[model samples]
Target: MLRSLLPIVEHAVKGPVWDCQMCGQCVLHETGMTCPMTCPKTLRNGPCGGVAVDGACEVKPEMQCVWVKANHRAENLPLLPQSWRDEIGHLRAPVNNSLAGDSSWMNLVSGADRKTPTGWKGSE
Candidate 1:
């Protein structure tokens, strides 16, 4: 219903600044709003071994690695949990287009087609 329309608005708002890939597992809350999809390697856990001298991404030398920036921000933000600083890992799996324009928040809450987090809710 109304929640379904929220994505259309969120996509319009968050897409530009965040380069939102619409991964369906939005990690913005975990990553200081730096979209993990911006990582060329899509490395969710952290920077790959090849982070450059200036902390730029190895895969995309011109750009800063999102994880490095996320770690820094995570440290300063009071509400962000300490565990998020160490909790880098793969985000579910790549989502298909069928979920392209949906509300990830609602999907996660409803447990519709979403993949549960590992070790969450007794998942293996």
Candidate 2:
């Protein structure tokens, strides 16, 4: 019951605020509270080297690059802790497609996001 409702509630809260894609393993804290999944290219690591001089996204000239916003917020957001600001440069794990639409809250409690996904090492 709760397992089914978690995703719905999570989406309801995160969707409009972060343009959440329900990637299930959220790195918002790591990425300055910005959702990299919302990027047009969904480039998890960083920008695609196409950011304009004015800080606009290459894919969408009018929109600011997600990484740019992430880095800026990571550094300048007064509410963020020093540790979170320092984490913007860390390399993040690739998206776990199997976890899509699942509840990250549950994954965090279960430590499911920490374990290597099945078949990532070898046959499950």
Candidate 3:
């Protein structure tokens, strides 16, 4: 009844959210078939303790964890080397606007450059 209709109504209201261009294959093919793009936290290394031993994502228990899927994908690709695992040790936080060369967003959002320091002097 209402429960069955809910899905139809929801789909009509929020259509196309589930559609993906499959461009994500680029991440897999280029990076040892490991997909950091689809991950919610976008972890490139491994699970963030947000998955159970059974490979269920803590954020969404009903769905397979991204890390687990990535591991499986990696296993099948013989050409894919394990070198990426070494690089993960030096993983840095994904840069946002400030570090992505879009400093204007940072300035607008954080007001970082709204005023100069009190003692600062600049040539006119």
Judging by TM-score against the true structure, name the best candidate. 2
Better of 1 and 2 by TM-score: 2
- My TM-score estimates for the predictions, one after another, are 0.69, 0.89, 0.42
Select the stronger candidate by lDDT from 1 and 2.
2
Question: Residue by residue across 1-124, what tens digits does model 1's lDDT show?
Answer: 7676878777888888878877666767767657777788876666788888789988777888778887777667677666774444334444444665677666677775456446455314
> Of the candidates numbered 2 and 3, which has the greater lDDT value?
2
Q: Order candidates by lDDT, high to low.
A: 2, 1, 3
Clash list (residue pairs), candidate 2: none
Q: Which run of 10 residues does model 3 get worst, by summed lDDT?
A: 18-27
Report residue 34 deviation for candidate 3 (angstroms).
3.4
lDDT of 2 by residue, 1-124 (tens): 9999999999999999999999888889889899999899998887888999999999989899999999988888878988888877876666878889999999999987666645555222
Estimate candidate 2's alpha-carbon lDDT, on a 0 to 1 scale. 0.87
How many clashing pairs per prediction, in order?
Answer: 1, 0, 0
Off by over 4 Å in 3: 1-31, 81-93, 96-124
Candidate of highest lDDT: 2
